[model samples]
Target: MSGFLEIRRGRAPLIVAFPHTGTDMPADVEMRFVSGWLARKDADWWIDDLYRFARELDATCIRTRISRSVIDVNRDPWGRSLYPGQATTELCPTTTFDGEPLYTGDGPDNAEIDRRRATYFDPYHAAIGAELGRLRAVHHRVVLYDAHSIRSRIPRLFDGELPQFSVGTNDRAACSGALADRIGELCGRSGHSHVVDGRFRGGWTTRHYGRPDDGIHAVQMELAQRGYMDEPADPSPDNWPTPIHAAPAIAPVLSDILSTCIAFAKGKE
Candidate 1:
């Protein structure tokens, strides 16, 4: 088992990835942070629990245990902005989403960034690529569902409260048109606010590995944190990550989404 990542193997033609759910901050890295709370504030909180049901579909799951504060596994290793011209975090962010500084000093320099990338970034993608290869070997098609979540309101990054479900296919270039449409339809019927190919149209993982022609269909599901948990207008260390509802409001819709993903990979949708 790689200490950096956790991988659960399955035979199904589906892979569920949780890139921002990690909160592990190595001692050396933690020392540079302004505070542990700010360092972990932007993490996709409780995402591991939110999507735990993916295990039931026998979907291969890959999750990084290293906090995004150390290195964002879903980001481009070369430091290219996923959402160009928009305010977003970096491969190794030095600030919180609210634009608060996270580092005591000048944060990670180029040398430190490179070191973190080699230590954390590479292995995460290797695991993902390895899983994709394994699944593709057994099945003609495989679906990589990159799961994530964020607070509903972050004006610095977005204009208004984000939709309950932000489904992204990198402008439909990552996955099949039919698959995108299916997810849109389900979200539309779920009675929750949702948008497709909006502000967030997937990330480096989706765009890099999503080769439909190669039998790999990738999609990113960015759920607004409000849908499943209470999102304070102004979050603090204590009240930020409210417990995920015993029964989240978006549970059934999420189930349908994953089920459809499996069906699409199996050519049943």
Candidate 2:
């Protein structure tokens, strides 16, 4: 019933959550974004389509339809940096991923950011937590797959290019060693470039909800946008449009990853 967030219940113990696939910009907030200020360019395009296997596998899913430009559901509410010393966006981003300013003049200040958190960020996280509780109540163990994607060659975010599959578990603290090792080995065997706890060592979602001791495990999968799409040279309104579709070639790779995750959770359960 909530437009800000959506949770699809599944029978499987695994949950596939897409926190960055949202593109909706509230009316009041939309005007705040100056025309061609690059707010829409930085969206995590078609991440939900990448994880369509969730529904097929009967995997629970918690997603937010609200744009990250409104409030990053993956960020820490305490304002802690997910990646320190790195140029990362905040709860309410001030610019696009390509370092383009989003507002001509002053945008939302401290008070506004806090209000958005209460309205969007807090509810989004609460949905995740509630879904985890729901799944755990049915299954012995529940695994959360925090899904995200970004442009592969964003020099502002990282040098060179991002690997196809970027896995993170907060340096193996978020889940059992066995689970992490299994996923890592599976990813490597799939012939895709995969890294464990590399630049994306999970986010607030994985760090906060991952409690192996409590029968809840969390892991983040950051994929390069190139893995699923032909990223435009410039991701903007004129160039990159809405309903960003995922390429068919990447389906098997992602489905394989999700299947592996489900197997791992079943094993743990």
Candidate 3:
């Protein structure tokens, strides 16, 4: 409940974070953008809604209503690339995932980028840390599940269609090997395409707070938008952001995934 950042506390030893589902754009910030539509195009559209079942598991949920177009909370504030040589956006991105310019004029300068990081990015992570501390005090182990979604095809970012389930543990540096293996086993039986440590291997949040030795097991689940919603091939303002209609089969799978996360945190193994 800190400005645009929202945190719902739960007794369960699990936390779900939505870093990119936000669409709120401040007037001053929007004025500098090429178009609001384009700025929001790459958002993890309706992702928070897709994972509504998290609440039923009594899992804490943390989210930011401030759009990623404003400042990607999941990215490293120090400006280091999470993927190093891969195609990705910055902490304060100047363009969309498709390499399209996002601002009418030159994007935010270094000073402005730093300001955004302080005003928006810092608080988001702070909230996450606070929740983790609270949950960890009660349980020996806690799970931080970073939820994200992207278009099935973004040629600029990856080759061919992205897998439906893109689980990332920073090559298993973020979470315990047992946790990673459990998630991998679930995805393998999901009847959907999946890859581990592929094009995406978790972002800064996953890499930073994930300390298995300290009992914080973090994992990032990046879903292909096509799995839960209609993703038009050529997305325009008119045909973009197809409504979220979780496929009948996909709904149960998502439930099971979160449930498994809860079980894992409870040491159910």
- TM-score for each predicted model, relative to the true structure: 0.98, 0.93, 0.97
State how far residue 93 of model 1 sits from its true place (Å).
Answer: 0.2
**TM-score between model 1 and native:** 0.98
Instruction: Give the 10-residue window scoring lowest on summed lDDT in candidate 1.
Output: 1-10
Ranking by TM-score: 1, 3, 2
lDDT of 1 by residue, 1-269 (tens): 14878899988899999999988888988988998888888889888888888899898999998889898888899999988889998899988888999889888889989999998899889989999999898898999999999999899999988999999899989999999999999999999999999989999999999999999999999999988888887899778778888889898899899999999989899
Across 28-68, the per-residue lDDT of candidate 2 in tens digits comes to 88887876336667777788876777799999888888888
After superposition, which runs of candidate 3 have C-alpha atoms over 4 Å from their true positions? 246-248
* TM-score of candidate 3 on Cα atoms, chains taken together: 0.97
lDDT of 2 at 168: 92
In candidate 3 the C-alpha lDDT for residue 5 amounts to 82
Candidate 1's C-alpha runs over 4 A off are none
lDDT of 3 at 150: 95
The local lDDT score (0 to 100) that residue 211 gets in candidate 1 is: 96
Cα lDDT of candidate 3 equals: 0.90
Clashing pairs in 1: none
